[model samples]
Target: MAEDDRSFVDHYAVLGLPSSEEGTKISLEEIKKAYRNQSRIRHPDKRPNDPNATADFQFLTTSFEVLSNETTRSCFDAKLRTRRERVLRDSFQNAKRRKMATDLEQRERSVAVDPSQEVRRKEKMKADELKREIAEFKARRMKKAFEPLNRKDNVEGEKKDSSLDKGRMLKAIWETSAGDYSAAKLRGIFETFGIVEDVVIRTNSLKKKSSAIIVMASKGATVRAIQSMSGDTTNPLLVLPLESIAPSFSSTSSTNQNESMGPEFNNVVGAGFQNYEAFVMKKLQEAYEKNKCM
Candidate 1:
């Protein structure tokens, strides 16, 4: 047979002894007989005219020498086993990678088929996010509205028990639309008012809109803060005044006040409002005057 026609080279196959899995248990006598039979046909002297006769004869001789030695045959078997294992491992790995690639391509094709569904999903997500933010904003507003009533109760409780009055610690409540202000920023802002005892920020989260309560060192300092901070300036402010937190304070028309005040202050109450301190101070003055008239 032509060299190109041969599938694979094996010592047993060269000798014409079976190389298949079931024929691996051939006897030494069988191997010698097969080798002798192959050699005679492939001998160069017997086929001197053939161009590949020498090469064929040499291959037959090598097969006999390797198979006849027990050590060489054992080593060749080990090498063959290792090559088979390596081929199987490579095939498994290639198959696994091909399967993964196929799955990814299928997913891409699915997405390409219905891109509109993806867009709709993203839009719904955005809408839900907006609704959540709006709900949080409304909750904060409600808390702000009821702050005065809560403070009123605390003041009344303090009044009923004289011993509880440890020289009325003056405190002021402040709200800011910009939630980026840290405790240090709050302290810096209100430190000008008086010796600050403690600063407490209340909010659902640090990143959300928040309120701060600045406890001043003395009532005199608190009084000074009410007078100085409550005023109109080039820049408007967003803050709650001392009168709003007082026990006697009450809105003349709660519903009307909320409807009117919420809208009226909208333009000036956001993070963009400039001169925030002054604007809030002016609003507090208006609220104080309105309550006094009522």
Candidate 2:
């Protein structure tokens, strides 16, 4: 056998005894017993026809000689332990070298770059950023362009809020020179312009005239009612704001005064009209002319 193979040969395995990579665990007596059994089986004189019997017997005798002595056996066991540890250490070092080489190769491949692809990637990023900026600019421009329209819509919304039930309460007077007007009839007539919250009819028996205090839901409704109803001479309605009436004819006092002094209430209302008569007549005349043209 080769010298390297001879150096790796286990003496306990040669004697047919149980052994491990670390070392054997046999006493001198146990070694002698194992040696005697192996010598009987591997002896040249006992195996006359076997061609390799002499070499096998020599190997067995060498194993027996080494294991039978304490000092030699200790040296052999130490050499076996050192050889096992060396093999393990070499295997670990080889594996670590292979991993480092693989990592270096991967890093080199990762560092290798395509210049055109890099430029394209940067250009794509810039384009995306520019698109985002343009979108933001367009949004700002659109908002600025529509600002006037938005303000107009807000003004219309404010007008609607004031004209509905939420804002100021306005009052108008409805006086008829000839016909008697019921509260329900007046409410029905005035509701065409807007909401009529209330209608209070007052009759003057001596003058044969009827008038009503119309409580409108809002200023817009009151204005619209006055514009539409003021200039009809046959069924005249002196639609005026309650604030335009005399100081004595307040909202609270008007009802009481109308009930107690029926004809005198009309007189007081006429007296209050002196201040606003021209303006009211102009608007009434314009409205009448417009209606007549229609």
Candidate 3:
């Protein structure tokens, strides 16, 4: 037979022996026993009426010849192993292709059933991504804004005084549409009224507005800034003292002038100031007068 024809045949199967153990473990005696039994059963003389009996008997003889020799048996076993590996590889590839086709078909069916669901799912994914990006952007911006303060504290080798009174703080609100203002710009603008210790800018993205927490060196500077900036048509900022927002000092009824004024506010509100309330009223009057002149 041709080499191709020989490769296609399972030699041990023809003699009715287990093909798995045939070449590796089957003894020569065992192969001979199987061959004798098969030869007797398939001999052409025994099946004279069967025309294909001759061909079958010839193939049986060839199988016995191949398996009986050690060299031929080893070669046949190698061919069988190669064919089995090729078959397994092809089966795996076909299965993979079938699973991919099935998945694609299911997706198409689902989209056809409810196309709006796909649209909604994609839109939700985009919205979630946008929210995450915005959150990260805001976090980066906050870290950048405070980096200078952090570095300054490190260089000075001192912790900032957290117990400092909030009474020296002023809130300045401005429209975002006006322009972008940095801490340095804000400090320059407010330093004309008093010594600005710190300027912290905050923004409301939704409202399109910005505000600054301006900490002055003393309560006197805080009151001076509030008096000068309030209701000033020239200045865009709307300034309010922290005392007005949330009063820090105790109120007292005083008949004598200058009796209730603290040492910090003595220079800002000179003589005739009866109390803290009177000093605030006087400053407001002065601001009104200044604006009326302007």
Better of 1 and 2 by TM-score: 1
Best by lDDT: 3
The clash number for model 1 is 8
TM-score of 3: 0.42
Query: Which candidate has the highest TM-score of all?
Result: 3
Residue-wise C-alpha lDDT for candidate 1, range 157-183, written one tens digit per residue: 778865433232333333455336666
Expressed as tens digits, the lDDT of each residue in 80-178 for candidate 3 is 887778778989999999999999999999989998997899999999999999999999999988776666767565444556688889887778998
What C-alpha lDDT do the candidate models reach, one value each?
A: 0.63, 0.68, 0.75
For residue 170, model 1's alpha carbon misses the true position, in angstroms, by 38
**Model 2, 124-240: lDDT tens per residue?**
999999999999999999999877767788999989966655222334443345455677877898899888887776666675445567777776776666545554433355555
**Local error of candidate 1 at 24, Å?**
4.6
**Residue clash pairs of candidate 3:** none
Clashing pairs in 1: 235-275, 236-275, 236-276, 236-279, 237-276, 237-277, 237-279, 237-280
True-structure lDDT of candidate 1: 0.63
